[model samples]
Target: MDIGAIAAAVMLAVSVRKRLDVFDGPADITTSLMMVGPLLVLGWLVAIALFGGYREDVFGVGTDEYKRVFNASLVTAGMLGIGCYLAKFQLSRGFFLLAFVVGIPLLLMGRLLLRSAIHRARRQGRLQYRVLIAGSPAHVDEVAAVLRREPWLGYHVAGALVPAAHLAEETASGIPIVGTTEHSTALVSTEDADVIFFAGGALSSASQLRTIVWELEKAEVQVVVAPSVTDVSGERIKVRPVGGLPLMHIDPPRATDAARWGKRLFDIVAAAFLIVAFTPLMAYAALRVRLHDGGPVFFNQVRTGRDGEHFGCLKFRTMVVDAEARLAELHAQIGFEAGLFKMKEDPRITPPGRWLRRFSLDELPQLFNVLRGDMSLVGPRPPLPREVAGYESDMMRRLRVRPGMTGLWQVSGRSDLSWSEAVRLDLYYVDNWSMLQDLSILGRTFGAVFGSRGAY
Candidate 1:
């Protein structure tokens, strides 16, 4: 893909150069560009390969893959400029600019496509690695839960190797206990695991951990150490090498940055554009809801916002006028879990309400709230007063940022998400808030809504 991208870029650059008339003609060059293009692309490919673009660990996750490609491109451009200057080669100025400008984005797009394919493959249970976890019962369960939560990460916990004293057939969360540390080495090859994880246990100490790592050295499988840290983004953690140890320095969470002007400006611009673009659709949905039973066109309910302030959240009325009155009756039937009120099949929802909620047209009115500065385009969901009353201290972190129309919770599973999982996703967004992440989530919202995977 990289080679193809570069070749396409060269063609594009040549045409752009001709259009701009940067030089007398293609013959102004000391040599034929078509012939030189291959050599240039080969150099770029070699630079990327030498810069670790093909490393196995970078394939499945993180921005490291993009970073390596970007760095390699910059270096290749620099070396090409120096070489051309020394060789007295008159590379068309317009072509040089167009090549890098167009080529880099094309290369990145290729990587994005490649990653999407890998994720799709992993979710289908193809290209997954069998993983063996070695840890105490508690740590083992925690690791397994994370793996199960994100199957696209391509890790399937085959079994656990717990301490000899805590041996069992399986730990909680259904990860079968394969064996104790006595058979740890044999189990890796026996289970045909592609990776072995060493979490907390008797192996918590450095010396013991080193011994275990050495034991698995000859296993020929990747060995990963699950640190005590969890839920921290890689961007916030930096590795600082001390005398003989690698110390991880973590930057404080960026929850406050969520309120910065950049995000507010982004919300305002995006919300206004969406409102203008969807006005006809919103009008049609509102008309349908009103005609369904001649109820109100919009639902305005007080919800908690940033800093615990109250605001009226707007949505197309997707339920009967007596929906609130019937809430308690439904709660009694299902028995509430985790203080969240939801039902897969609630009698209160009107006929049009189901489709409205399914496509998320009901949430379109919230764009007004976003423009009003009462909410953001992407943040935690706005909680009701009753829900806020039950929030634990940790859960209150979500209030630091404005509530969002669609968030991690919505994209992940919407109404089907467990309360705890919802809180975790919201807090993760608050701590790791970035404009790039917000745009990515917004793009994904369409897929989630259309699929109606967890929407009622």
Candidate 2:
């Protein structure tokens, strides 16, 4: 895949340069293609390899692989730029810029497609690593359950090894306890395990883990240690050696004032652009709502925002007039809980309203809220006043950030999420807010909306 991406990038660069008349003659173009392009491709591949792009640990898992690729591309571009300047190659500036601009997205898209195909294959029980989990009973079960939940990560639990003193009949998580940790090496050999995962606080001592690692060195099995703390971004964690011992230093999640201001500025600019870009669609939707039953075009409701402030959240009306009046009756009929009100198929929805809700067109008017500083482009869900009243102390942490037009909750499961699950996601976003995370969420929102899952 890396070779293919490099070849495609080289071809694209040559084609773009030819179209832009960058070459003085056919010989110049041919020489550049044969010499400059190959060097650039080679440098980029070497950078990617150094960044662990080819490692199996990152192949079918999280955004780490994509992040590395992006970083590698940027480094390659910088080095090539410097090399061109020092060597007086006099490369066309426009052509150089076009190559990277075109190539980066293409590389990322190719990897995304490849990941999807690999995930599909893994789901069909192919191309999976045989994993042997080593931990205490509770830790083993916890790790095994997590691995099972995310099968796309490509870890197939061959078995587990608990403490020798453990008297449990078997792993409560359903992975068989093949042997005790004392005999982990034999267990690995018997199961032909490709990877051995050690859950945090699982082993009896650090020396014991070192022994196990030493024993497995000759066996050529990869050893992984799962930290107890999860869900924290790699950017916030740093490893520093203190007193000859490696210690993990976790940075506070708080953003600097500059970052906060930058996010607000991004929200303003993005909201303005989207509002102008979707004016025609918004106008048509408003007309449909107005002509449906001669009711108001917009719906406004009081919702909680940053710092527990209340604001009027706006949306294109997606229900009949007097929808609020019928809410209680419908809630009673459908058995909706008092905290989060959601009915998959409600009688209150207008004909056009259903389509609007399905595609999230109903939320278009919230750009006004974003522009007015009552919300952000990406943050926690704008909570209802009633929901705010029901919040416990921990749940109220969500009020630390401005409410958003669309958010983690919106993309994850929308109306189908339980109240607790929704609150959990909102808090997670609040504690782990970053520009990259916000961008990732916004990008996924499109797919979620198109998939139309849990959107009602």
Give the per-residue lDDT of model 2 (tens digit) for 143-237: 88778756777889988888778745587767888888888888899989999999854587788888988999899899988777655667778
Instruction: Indicate the residue-level lDDT of 77 in model 1.
Output: 90
Q: Top TM-score: which candidate number?
A: 1
Candidate 1 per-residue lDDT, tens place, 274-385, comes to 9999999998898899888999999999999999999999999988998888877777788765567778887888888898988988999999999999999999999998
Model 1 alpha-carbon miss at residue 430, Å: 1.6
Clashes of each: 0, 0
Q: What TM-score, over all chains together, does every model reach? A: 0.92, 0.88
Model 2 CA deviation exceeding 4 Å by range:
21-28, 60-64, 78-97, 120-126, 158-160, 164-166, 170-176, 255-259
Native-referenced Cα lDDT, model 1 = 0.87
Candidate 2 positional error at 319, Å = 2.3
Global fold similarity of model 2 (TM-score): 0.88
Error of 2 at 49 (Å): 2.2
- Among these predictions, the greatest lDDT belongs to 1
